[model samples]
Target: MPHTKTSDEVRIAYQVRGDGPPLVLLAGQANDHHWWDGVRDDFTASRSTITIDYRGTGESDKPHQPYSTERFADDVVAVLDELAVDRTDVYGTSMGGRVAQCLALHHSHRLRALVLGCTSPGGQHGIERSSEVRRSLVQPNPVDARQALLQLMYTPAWLATHPGPYYTLGDQSMPTYARRGHLVASNRHDAWDALPAILAPTLVLHGTEDLLNPTANAPLLAARIPGARLELIQGARHTYFEERRDLASPLVLEFLDQKVPLQ
Candidate 1:
């Protein structure tokens, strides 16, 4: 149980794998570090991958205080600092992408590259999840939540073909208050104005069928962030990186491996 203390003194539990350049994997609103279990091997084959539990998720602290993306971004920076890593590539999905945006804007020097997946800049400028998807998450039981996620976060073919993985992806060990804190914090995130300040070379990937963070957000994010590229995975939903790893992983690896022109 490797842990790091943030500036705020919150304990952040994290895991590291492989032994090349560092790559951090940031989990989403409803997930902890364990959420990366499904795809950690894909990146660990080359890069030194790091995945951490958000303050209110997994093994991190939950103090009942208000949460913000800035706070989460700081935690990421603290994790890197604790590991004595000056900079590293980051792959952030959903809510974690919002945190990544904050990091890239505020801690530009600490990033080698960035990959934003299934995320948005927020406000009316970016599209949102469907009402059906939204409604399903409110106070739903685990069984219901799993079913809804499988329907909205994954394509029918992937869900049908990968039942085992699909079921395992539903694991969420965080408490209700903590999960609610993440939701509240994520809802308040609005980084549209901050996009232009992200100096890190970036790749914006989105699933065409992602109802959580609509596909339109991808191109919008890319256009706003200078030098950012966009790629839309066909028929993929929110969890495309896992549900459609065969397609998503290659793009991520290629992007991570390529050299970013000096600024």
Candidate 2:
């Protein structure tokens, strides 16, 4: 694992693997780079893949300070600056998607393409998860909470065969404050008005069955960004890119490879 220091001096950990065109993979809330374990190789087969452990997870230094998606995006920019990557495509899911939005908005020069999955713009403009889904996520027992999260992230059939826990549980070792910071940052994300200004070719993907961020946000995201495209995977859940990467990865690759007229 390689590391870079942000302007704030927090050490952010990142990994670069394989070769060819670059693609940065951003992790979801409280999750580390391993969140992409199931689909990383797919992208890496043809493109150099860069994965970053946001300031509060994996091997990164976690400081007890406020976190915002914009700040998280800056952490990514620091990593790219350290690696000498001038521009690359990006794929982000859940909280990672929120961070990606900020990255595209704040550092437009650093991206060639963008893919956002199962995430919202936050604030009052985005569609929130249902109250029932929200309650299930906060169960006192870790076991119950993990199970509930799995249910929301994958289909019943997928969970039936893969009973073992995946990356959906996030970093169990993450500090309480770091977790809280991630939650607050995600809750405050409001890129609705700014999305239209994005110049990179963008793709918004969501599972039709996604209950966490809700599938509606995908189309909303696509519509908000000028000339962005939306794709909904049928029968999949929040982590559709992971659970059905077989179907989703190709869409991402195709979109990244296509040349869209500059907006």
Candidate 3:
């Protein structure tokens, strides 16, 4: 229930947990802070975790206007500023990864390291989904929207293990207005060219079977960034964190704790 009122006057809801260096978690399209629920325990064991609801999502204030990725990035900066956190590790997924990339390019000093998961460089012409899946997301029902999203985020193997959690989380956190705003924001995002400017010690995690964003994005990101490392989670999809936590968590912890350049 904790919130930060940004300079732009948006009330951003966030949750901070655990103890140690701060790790901010950024959720993707139509997702709220709860998107990191499955990985919270794993992360909190070694570091403090900050999960936020982007403007127009979850408990955050939703303003009626055009949305841009830069605005969302600013929203994140505002959250960190409000918390008085000088610098911290950032973990971003899908659209959240785009925001992270923007932050690294625009606000490099605020980050200790970066973790980009199941995301893509936005400027490219990426994978296209079937019409059915696209239509279901824009529908009014959060449950249906979540089901459609999960189908895109996770592989068949993952869906087999986790069936109902995605829908329940969506129903609890996703709202129709927020979803529309996120879609609008997503359409406006473009970060492919900016990847070269990111200086943070970066870790790019992608699912080999990710349908929404192709796995090629991992190599593209790793190649562009000065020293970014890429890890492909085998048999995993966009939602690899939930599907292969056993494999993903250890790798992330090691990368954030070890690979990041120390200031």
Best by lDDT: 2
Candidate achieving the largest TM-score: 2
Q: Which stretches of candidate 2 lie over 4 Å from their true place?
A: 260-263
- lDDT on C-alpha atoms for all candidate structures: 0.84, 0.90, 0.80
**Candidate 1 local lDDT, 53-146, one digit each (tens):** 8887777787788888888999998889989999899999998899999889889999999999999998778788778778886544867876
Q: Per-residue lDDT of 1-263 in model 2, one digit per residue for the tens?
A: 78999999999999999888889998899899989988899888788899999888999999999999999999999999999999989999999999999999999999999999998887788999899999998899989998898888888899889876597669888999999999998898899889899998999999999888899999899989999989999999998998898999999988988852222
> Which tens-of-lDDT digit does each residue in 1-263 have in candidate 3?
98999887889998999988889888877678888877789988778898888888789887876677788888888889888999999988888888888888899999989999887776654444457656876779977876776777776666787566562134245456666778778766777777888988999998898766677778887888888988999988778887888999899899987965333
TM-score of 1: 0.93
TM-score of 2: 0.97
Worst 10 residues of 2 by lDDT: 254-263
3, model 2: CA deviation in Å?
0.7
lDDT of candidate model 1 versus the reference: 0.84
User: By TM-score, how accurate is candidate 3?
Assistant: 0.89
TM-score of each: 0.93, 0.97, 0.89
Q: In candidate 1, which residue ranges exceed 4 Å CA deviation?
A: 139-142, 165-171, 260-263
Residue 126 lDDT, candidate 1, scale 0-100: 74
For model 3, the superposed segments whose C-alpha errors exceed 4 Å read: 125-148, 167-175, 261-263
